[model samples]
Target chain A: MCIVCGCGHAEAGTGEPEHDHGHKHHHSHGSRLDFGGGPAGVSLPGLDQARILRIETDVLAENDLIAAHNRAYLSEHGILALNLVSSPGSGKTTLLVRTIADLKDRFPIAVIEGDQQTSLDTERICATGVPALQINTGKGCHLDAHMIDHALTTLAPGQGSLLLIENVGNLVCPAGFDLGEAHKVVILSVTEGEDKPLKYPNMFAAADLMILTKTDLLPYLRFDADRCIDYARRVNPKIGILRLSSETGHGLAAWYDWIEARRIPVSQQED
Target chain B: MHEMSLTNGILRILEDQARTRNFSRVRTVWLEIGTLSHVDPEAIRFCFESTSKGTIAEEACLVILEPAGQAWCLDCSQSVTVTRRGDPCPICGGFMLHVTGGEELRITELEVE
Candidate 1:
């Protein structure tokens, strides 16, 4: 397992042996049996008194530090960075493809695709003739600040450009990690349950915008758009709600307007 | 699922402390996980054991302190206890509750040698 993110890299577990940071040490002692036993089963013995150090450190401090640096870097470059998060099969990539095609002429758009194993999403984004970088996180669930910092170096989006970071298809973990995006846009497909916001409140609460995608399927399916928005509002009253369908181009204009509203004006970009 | 990454975070902290504090082995780790932090204590324990293997914190005792979620009810204008993130304010039954506390994930103290 990679110690940084605990990614097992279950598939194609070859040629990356150096990434595996953990050592497979088979100790006979169990976790339950090792409590306050005076370190009897410790691998390193002959230690003195157990010093109680009052550290009180935040676990995500390192990631947050890197994320701060990324935010500053993006702000200095006048890049409108958006971190797109959603569950699997939410048509996030399709939405990105459509968004890119719609605004590519007006703005220099780039993408950073994150997934556990394949470069498929990156390839799909690159088909739009935009520079895209694929970050295979292996078993890592979400993209962290450090990963985004590294991706920024390679996929260097132009000044005053839009950087769309498509996070891995998981709603939970991505909510916690700040990828230095100006706003987090979370997508909830209408095909899914309406009570998803209640089930995944953290993700809903963390998002600046809650995009209700696949609205074209709403008529065919028994999905309540109002109730879903209400549920999302229950978690985050200030969250902006947008209903769009990438397939039929429904509500795409409003989505485009929303993006344009957040963009820094060309005149201000010089500042 | 994300606990694996969190365990890695803990491991990094332990490694840093070992170098600065001059400790070769970690005996116990006291973690303060809040209810709204979205991290399961059991899953963290399991992941920590696996990720900390061959590290300075291998076989270390993990003492997790889970604090209950607390929120400020906008309707009632009072502080209330909440166990879950989406749960309404217990007193007023209002969903307009702003989270006030219990979202911490920190390593409070460590027993090292």
Candidate 2:
């Protein structure tokens, strides 16, 4: 028994009679591979008889559990939560500002802005005459499901309303975490590299839609829209693509249409 | 990096297992990471080594098993091996490949006492 925790074998690494041997052995018999072969020990000293315990589990299980709770809660309340992800300066805030401006009267809209620092994005979102909350992650790269759960309790968006979560401006880390949104929408501006989808295939693969922002600058820049679309499709064949210029109000109608089409009603009927 | 989060998750699992299974310490961790999972094994190792300190899994050894990514080719009607996400089918050389396997990042086993 462990002297420290009183669980097993006197803490495995302390100076016990079990520490006198050079227990290092690597042998495989049949299909089982044995290590040390006596008893499984801790970090040092005795590796003679270590026990192998099979526990097949995902590392993100905890996060995924919380995300599932968020999903069920949102679905029950007839809420449409969209997770917006993009690299820095991809015009997510600008596009959101425009989108909220146009759709605020049509339905109730709330925003949850995530950033490492500063409430500037949340401030911009609130300026549109809509309720918005800012979650500063401090050192976190992306917002997790637990944070979203807290934000939901604090925000308390109306039933059958739209909730937009603008994730920290990152193309990489956010792809791995599921925030229990209806869909993950990745925004890429024309000013950036057209091959971003290929460069960050994980994000493209995880996203349900790819919004090509800053289309008004297409004439001034040499960004190839067709190639960009091809690359995005290469990663995710079913990803919906949209081209919009928030500055010129070019393709906002289609975007708003997409949102309205997916918004779940309080008594939504299933097909 | 998200590897940090993944490592923290591994630690959480280890601690939880220790409590339930009545293990005092963890000696080694066996993880199966897919080639196309976008999780670098080296980065995971580094993150685990750093974060596992002062925890029940402190000084625990990490053993990573990388499985090859496999994709199904719609044009060829065959499954082919892929190393990256956007790689075309090796047999048909077409881009109509859908990933079918090898996106797992799971802990398969543990050595504890």
Per-model TM-score, in order, reads 0.85, 0.86
Please give the TM-score that candidate 2 achieves against the real structure: 0.86
Q: Per-residue alpha-carbon lDDT of model 1 for A158-267, expressed as tens digits?
A: 99999999999998999989989999999999989999999998999889999999998887999999999988988887799999999999999999999999988888
Candidate 1 collision pairs? none
Candidate 1 similarity to native, TM-score:
0.85
Which lDDT tens digits does candidate 1 get at residues B16-88? 8889989898888878777788788899999998888899888999887666677788899988888887777
Which residue runs does candidate 2 get wrong by more than 4 Å? A1-50, A266-271
Model 1: reference contacts kept, as a fraction: 0.61
Candidate topping DockQ: 2
lDDT of 2 by residue, A1-271 (tens): 2111112232224333331212222322334433334343233344333466667788888889999999988887888999999999999999999999999998899999999999999888989999999999998999999999999999998888899999999998999899999999999999999999999999999999999999999999999999999999888888999999999999989999999889985568232
CAPRI verdict on model 2? Answer: acceptable
In the range B1-113, model 2's lDDT, one tens digit per residue, is: 88888888899899899999899899888787877886889999999989998998899988786766778899999888888988778997788888976778888668787
Candidate 1 chain A, poorest ten consecutive residues by summed lDDT: A19-28
